[model samples]
Target chain A: MKRRSNSDGKSVKAGRRGTAARKRRPLPTAARKRRHLRTAVRRRTASVGRRERRDQRLARELDDITEQQRATSAVLRLIGGSSGDLQPVFASILASAVRLCDAHTGVINRWDGEALQLIATHNMPPAYVELRKRSPYRPDQHSASGRMLATRAPIHIADLAADKTYLGGNPPTVAAVELAGVRTALAVPMWTEGKLVGSFTVGRLEVRPFTDKQMEIVQDFAAQAVIAVENTRLLTELRQRTDELRRSVGALQRERSNRLMNLEAMAAAISHEVRQPLASIAANCSAALRFLAHDPPNIEEVRAGLNRTVNDSHRASQVFDNIRALFGKADQGRQAVDLNGLARGVLDGLRGEIEDRGIIVELASAPDLPPIIGHRGQLQEVLINLVRNAIEAMDLMTDGRRTLKVRTERSAADKVSVTIEDSGPGIDPSQIKGIFEPFVTTKARGMGLGLALCRMIVERHAGQLSASPAQPRGSIFRVVLPAGRNAATDATG
Target chain B: MNGQPEPQPIVFVIDDDSALREALSSLFRSVGLQAKAFASTSEFLQMNLPEAPTCLVLDVRLPGLSGLDFQSELAKANIDIPIVFMTGHGDIPMTVRAMKAGAVEFLPKPFRDQDMLDAVQAGLDRDRSRRKNASDAAKLKATYDTLTAREQEVMRLVTAGLMNKQIAGKLGVSEITVKVHRGNAMRKMGAKSLAELVRMADALGVRRTMS
Candidate 1:
């Protein structure tokens, strides 16, 4: 009975130990559950942070695209507003380039065939403005502006301290740019009509390289600058031509008015000179018939009155015949006329009138003065009218010093000149301006058509007539005729 | 066969231009006629002469009045002067108006000497006969006034182709008294015969309407 009681007690103790181990495993399971909860929270927080970072990146990219588009639109607006005045157009271009590229300075240099003149500048120093006035940079020379102009392309000088073209040159421009703290510069040529007219440049003072966006804005500015330069030159040429045409029209209007006033004055003078002699002839004939009827007939007294009446009637007829020759119907025919012999005939016709007025006429002409081709009667009329006028002009002078000198000379080019000079009161300076206009005369009771008719005859012969004040109180008239094709030339030059 | 003297008619000249007057006076003298020239009509009127036969040579234009006006004035004054008109550059209307005014002749200036002489001669002959007829009428009027109203009636009947007995019965007078009054009237009128007495009454434009 004692061995059965000891085995039951050992079985109870082993069951107790198994119960303790089961309780320890419940504690570890709770700890593992807490660790799994912490891992789930950590994964949720990491996903939220990654989504916020992606949203911020997308926003940044959209802002950069808008900024680039704004710059491109600003450059287009500048080019649209420019009209041909190149100085203003280029200045705006330089300003627009500086603002678009966000650079420190910009300039446009013009090539005037001998020098590079600073046409326009923006944000540049005063020293650079003054140096550009006298600077001459040839196209083949080693210069950033020159390289851009010669190749008609864009040139970039990055890191001015490392550039070889900037070394060992006495150029004031290089030293100026270096002192301005510019580290990068770009130049683009302005071309118009297939020729390089100038160059445009942009610079950065803080040693930064130009981005592609900045280069594109500068290239667009250069293209607009070229167009503006071409328009301005064409506008200047058009204005000059317009000015020349206006001056020519003004001169033609003045000439037309002068011709109209001359014609009216000539008609008034012709009517007044022909009426005086006709009235005296009618009165003398009525008195002669009364004397012949007396008883112790006075025949001798009647005969004397009859003879006087006949002479006055003949004098009136000659005045009308001279007037008819001037304005008769036209019958133009060409013939060869002796110049010297015609001159002598005109002098002889007026010899009596000249001597009665006490005018000493001196005639000097070359013996072999060539025969001229003209109408004989018209030419004689011109010579006689001129000689008669000269003799009459000296009629008021009582002194024996009155003279008329007529001369003919042959020029070296086979032209002929006939000059008539008179020692009368010289023509007034104001009257000489219109001396050839009809009815512009100084003589009392003088019809002023003589000189005008003379000029018309001279012009018809393809010659020229001019007048000037002669030396020492007189006037001179010169007539020039072109040589005939068959006339001999003066060989003894 | 009486030895009585014939009256000479005076010639009157009127002109405006002195030269034309001197010319016309010489022309009139060469024709054996006496002419007195006056510069105007007023000058000729101031020299009033007797009521004799006078011939007037008048210019068409004058300073104060024209020749036609003077001719009408003379007719209104009963002067009985015959006129010959002269002109220089006379138009056709002026010539027609002058002729209608009883002008004897119209002469244009620069005229022939014979034309003036012929015109003046015709004018003088007409004026002399007219003046003689006027004087004879005045004398008959004087004698008729002296013989009373019966003599005028007798003279009128005698020139009317009536017998003395018909004339006495019409005048209510005796035949012997009618013959005596007729003889006195014929003697005053300077008529030599009954035919002359009839011509004198006809020239005076006297008419008797027998009722």
Candidate 2:
């Protein structure tokens, strides 16, 4: 208004000067010079006034731009601060739009392709808020939001009371005009990735239409609302994917450990138990022949060689006895067995295998450990199976050290225990109890009888076999057996 | 086949099983070779070996380190003992690695007694020849070091196939002076002929100063 009046006053002055110039043209040269000086002075003063008005207009525009930026940054800060909760974010966005656009009330409605539901409202009257809560709004030509829904564009109503929806007695529009005293309104549709997600609408209580700048401010708020919604959805999706990955990794590790144990058991069954005795037998026979072929016929050396052959033959047959004991009833071959010696024997038998796999073995045998009474061979078989399982378990570890620790100690006055631990991927705690059940092998090959037979042999001797998790990483299997009464009696005697 | 009095040759057997190690020792003893047995490589390594022709009978799979790794360890420690590798579960890749590292033999168990004996005998022969060459070079170096500097120069040029006059010119001496140095070098090195002198020079890695 001020700029327009200033321009009108300057034009009126210019017309008066033109009429005065025509009258003064008939005067002398000195009078014309004085008139020209006066006119020049007046023109300078008018331009100065024009410049001041333009500066004031520019300053006012700068303030409006600063206010718009401040409002946008506040909404952005709220979106960042609230992790995925969209309630406060939506409220803040609608409130800013209403305040920045010089309107009385603002609302954000979520459109689910069928109807628009009011999700957020700011400063809306109680009657209007209650009227919209009764039912969702479907797409209709009479409503501004419905028009925005159909066109997917911003809609502006200059005067709500003169609008057809108000005249036709649309209940929400009538509530807006009579209850809230709203006239001018602006509604902008929110879009996310080319899909219309919702609408942001603000209304004024007086009949003053919103300018283009105010319309743009509403659009900016709608876009920020879209970002908050999309951010929440992506965050939820990422969380779900992380949970799924963790579950699969755990399952794969369990399966691999089971498979490795079974595979190593099969190989150990053939290579160590059977092959060692066979090789020893062959070597003894060859030595015996060489001794007999001596120039003097060294009968003592020859006899020693033949004795070794006999012992190795017995050693070879023990492997079958173990197999039979696995399937049939318990053997009657009980004896006074030192568990420390048994653990050592098992480790010695697997020395080649241990070295081949590059595993470091640490044996901690307690001094003067009380002896246990059991079938020595079956007990040795149990220890061998456990140690073999430990080795195979560690073979799967690619990063950590491959270490096998075999420990023996007297657990009680009447009991001796052997523990074999490995640095490998440990067993799942939930599956620890179920692992000893028959036919529960995780390997693709072989009958899963390794641990089952170990447990059976242990129980037959009145001993207990159990598995547990090791520290840092890996698994441990411990065997506990009763002490030998005969050995104790002999020592006492 | 020199007539020097040599110490008895020994065969060292390294096996994890004491029974198998004893049997192998007995087999070697019956063939009139002195035998030593150890339960592991560490035990064998701790022994102070005598200066005699010796060979090792190594089990491919042992307690601490595999036989292939042991072979490299020995090389790293500058112990050039000949090894006869025996494995119960010999695979082709293991055999290739052992043989590539200069093992005397890679025999899978239970090998024939004859094959074992032959591998042992071959390993002993190779060790004897290696010892002989090393001693021969040492002796040649010692003898070459005893000569005067001019005599050593004459010897290097003589081994390079230079004539007496050319050697004299290269050394800035008269032909007679070069001849005298060459004679002194041959006598001190115990070379029976010029050819023998040249062979000694080559063994000592002598280079002609001129070229």
Candidate 3:
């Protein structure tokens, strides 16, 4: 029993020691729970702050993207308004790309079917501009812009220096980017009418690669740039078509007016040349009957009547030949002719009739009158008609105080003028302006074609003919002609 | 018809047209009259009139002076020739002006040959009486020249109804001498009696002045 009691005492002693060990080693659940709660709160707060920052950044980025889209759209609208010159549109696209992408430089490179030409650049150095001008890069296997054009896809370079796939090896564009402290770059094809016409490239100075969001923004702007180019092309095409139509319409109007003037001139020539000879014939016939009634018939008087009839018949034949010449289907023949000489010849031929009618004809010429280049026969016809009309107007003066003054002078640097003034009953003021029109005459027996035919002949020679009432009485007709080269040289001396 | 030779009629033709003038000369010759044509009044003025029977066929409008002016000139000269005026296209005023000037006939141009000839004949007949009277007056004057002044006084007294014895008492002569002067004067003057002598004197217009 004493042994069982000693064992019990030892058990108590061991139990006591075990209780002392339990006290010495307390339970760690509270500290562990506290440590676990503190860790969980710290992790949750950090997660929430990160989420807020991300949302704010996304909102700001979205606003930036919206602003960029609006700016690009506005630039495209401005390009559309400017009717098709590609310079302004290219400038706006390049400048907007630089601003929107926050890049150091931006360039719009045009692939003109054979070569890649830098059309527009924003934020590029002057030295780069000079370098690019000297060594123009062509679109080939060695060009960065060329690959983007050939593939018609987007290209990105995080570090141009480190990148292995740079097609254009250190060209001016790449060099310019390097000088601008740009490492990351993006290139997108610019399309027009579903064809890759050019490329839009954005470069950054730092090694911050373009995110998907930034790439999307750039692509949207690239799309807007392409639309602007296409709009400009259609505008250019419309402008060309309008110009062609205007030219055609103008030519048609000229043809119609020419035809009308020709028809009028033809009719006038026919009537004036035909009726005068017929008048002379009828008068001679009447005078012949009077001579036959003499008691001892005057043979001389009878002979005079017969001679007059024969002369008139010959004159009628000449008029017919002139008509044939006018109507013949022959091309106009151009020649150099002395206008002063022609005027003198016509005046000399008409001098006899003028003297018989008691009219005074005076000719005044410039010291060195110019020769005109034209059809000689046509010019003669014009001068003769004008001179004859002047003579006829003075026919009724009984006291024989009629004067026809023909004067010539140089009018302009390359033009010469001839003026014929007559002292007779002047053209009526109301009829002066329209005298060149057909069928307008003030003569009692006149066919009213003299002036109309004169206008046509003058116009055919590339000259102008016009008439005005003379100072006191009668009319003055002025003709202006382009002087020939020889004539001008002679005139200078 | 009265034992006298038929009077030769003279025709004066005037026309402006030379052809019509020759044609008219031929036409007048075919009718057996002495026809003379003058171009104008000036030509006709220098011409002498025939003593037989003369008729003027003058154009209305002559070169120097008009036909109406010529007619007036003829009247002023106391010419007793009858006029037959011709016209080309006569207006009423011209015709009336010609007829009032004692034209025997006014013939328009292009007239029938018969019409012209008849008009000429009528003018010549009227001119014949005037010429005969003028010639008779000249013959009376020649016969009277041979007589004394006493015989003319006796003729004037007898035609004035004074008897022969009264004429002898007024002139202090014997009745037989007065009767002898009257008988010689009447016979020399180609009068058959005293009344016949008075008739001749009246026809000569001597009796009007004597009375």
Q: Top TM-score: which candidate number? A: 2
Estimate, for each residue in A1-493, the C-alpha lDDT of model 1 and write its tens digit: 2112122333465477569637533336677788558656855775586467446545644554465456545545644554545665566667767875778888887777766667888877877777656665554557665666667789888876666556646364475455455668888888887887788888888667776656776887787777667666766677888888898888788656544543443342343233223322333333345556566656764565455546544644654565565445323455666767877888887789778767788999877776666667767766776676666556434464889998877754656777788887767799787867653432212222457667766665667778898888777888776555432221111
Model 1 residue-pair collision total: 0
By summed lDDT, which 10 consecutive residues of candidate 2 chain A come out lowest? A439-448
Displacement of the residue A122 alpha carbon in candidate 3, Å: 1.2
lDDT of 2 by residue, A248-342 (tens): 99989976875565445445444444655666677678777877877778899888888887887886687666567654444555567888888
Candidate 3 clash pair list: A142-A167, A292-B19, A293-B18, A293-B19, A293-B20, A294-B18, A294-B19
- Rank ordering of all candidates by TM-score, starting from the highest: 2, 3, 1
Worst 10 residues of 1 chain B by lDDT: B16-25
Q: Judged by DockQ, which candidate is best?
A: 2
Cα deviation of B77, candidate 3, in Å:
53
| Model 1 native-contact share | 0.00
RMSD of each: 26.9, 17.7, 26.7
Q: What shift in Å separates residue A476 of candidate 2 from its native position after superposition?
A: 13
Ranking 1 against 2 by DockQ, winner: 2
Over A1-493, each residue of candidate 3 has an lDDT whose tens digit, in order, gives: 1112121233455466467535533337898687669858966986797578557656765677577768877786787587667777767777776776667778777667876677777777777666766776675654566577778888888887676444345575467555565678898988866777777888887776776656766787778777876787777788899999999999999768766866765654554434444434443444445446656665565576567667766866876676666545323455677777888998998789688767777888787876777767767777877887787667533453689998889899888888999887777798687777654432212222356666776775567898988977888999998889733343333
lDDT of 2 by residue, B1-211 (tens): 3587998999999886766777787788778889999876767877998899999999786643567878998999999999999875646888899999999999876777788889999999999999999987777777778999988888888888899998888778899998899889888989999888877777777855444
- Candidate 2 CAPRI assessment class: incorrect
Residue-wise C-alpha lDDT for candidate 1, range B10-78, written one tens digit per residue: 678886444345445544544546668887676788797555566888867553355776788888998
